[model samples]
Target: MPSLTAVCRVHALLDDSGSVGVTAIDKRPVDGPVEVKRLGVRGDVQASRAHHGGPDKAVYAYADSDAEHFAGILGYEVTPGLFGENLRVDGLDVTGAVIGERWAVGETLVLQVTMPRTPCATFARRLGESGWVKRFQAEGRPGAYLSIVKAGPIRAGDPIEVVSRPAHGVTIGDVFAGLEPEQASKLLASPAPRLSEIVHGLAEKALTRAAVGA
Candidate 1:
């Protein structure tokens, strides 16, 4: 079991301060319990809704271990919410968490693992590091995106308990591994309804690649 170490959110900004204009990558920690809904954390605003904050990606979760790994690489201490993640969890292998896996946060809120967070230009600019997108991709520890299964309040220090796990072993890391055809097939065939759409998209990509090979 893991614990929620921090909860965060941010308001959208229109200024072109960072490399990405009109962004809300600057997330700050919020005190006490915060409401989690289908859209996202209450008060959290996504400037680029096209790429973030939808039903499938209602919440972003990152592991403390991953932050530590990045800290060792970047030579700076990475704090919770600094990566714009809505939840900072401790003692969870988020990369290894299977898609469609259900987690009970606190006593009421339930969340299902959806997809992995792919690094974007905004993420690179947040780090002020060049080639960060490539570096992050190569690292292959992209955090997990979660969809609210049972909307409720989540707060720091809430226990995260695994409620269910899909039989398919298509973990977030596997998706970050370029969604191989085999894994994609398994995910697509999974009985978990929450994973259907995501796996379908991956399966389509696999088909395209196979067609090209043919």
Candidate 2:
């Protein structure tokens, strides 16, 4: 069982040099319990709704182990929330987390794993590193994005409970690596109650693309 080591948030603001004209990628640690809602954590903002936020990506979680891996490579201390994650969890195999897996945060909040965080140019600019997106992809430890299944409050040091795990066995990393039609089909056909319709649609899209050799 993993523990929530830190909670973080940031306001949306303009970044002239970023790939995205504006971003909320500069998150910092927040103390005490914070409200969790359908859209996202209270006070947290996403400048680009199309690529971030909404029901499917309400919360982003990254494992401390993953951060440490980056820190070793980047040659700097990569603290919690530095990567714009809402939660910094310790001992969670974020890359290996299966899609549709549900985790209970503290006593109330329920979150379902949805997808992996795809590195973009905005992330690169935040790190002030060139080819960072490519480097991150090669590292293959993209964190997990979660959807609020049951809204409540979450705080640092909260214990995480695995309420359910989908049997599909497709991990967040698998999706990041680009799922094949067969792999996508298995996930779409899963009996997991936490699996969202949006995920099904994505699997269908992948199947279509595979069929067309796209």
Total clashing residue pairs per candidate? 0, 0
Global fold similarity of model 1 (TM-score) = 0.94
- Please, what is the whole-model Cα lDDT of each candidate in the order they appear? 0.87, 0.88
Runs of candidate 2 with Cα error greater than 4 angstroms are 11-14, 18-20, 194-202, 209-214
Give lDDT tens digits, candidate 2, residues 68-168.
99999999999988899999999789999999899999989999999889898888888889899999999999999999889999899999988888777
Cα RMSDs of all predictions? 1.9, 2.1
Error of 2 at 29 (Å): 0.7
Candidate 2 has an lDDT of 0.88
Model 1 per-residue lDDT tens digits across residues 1-214: 6999999898456465543467887787899989999888999998877787889989999999999999999999889888889999999999999888999999899999989998988888778898999999999889999998899998999999988998888889988887777777787677665563665687679867977988
Q: After TM-score superposition, what is the CA distance of residue 65 in candidate 1 from its true location, in Å?
A: 0.3
Question: In model 1, where is the ten-residue run with the lowest total lDDT?
Answer: 11-20
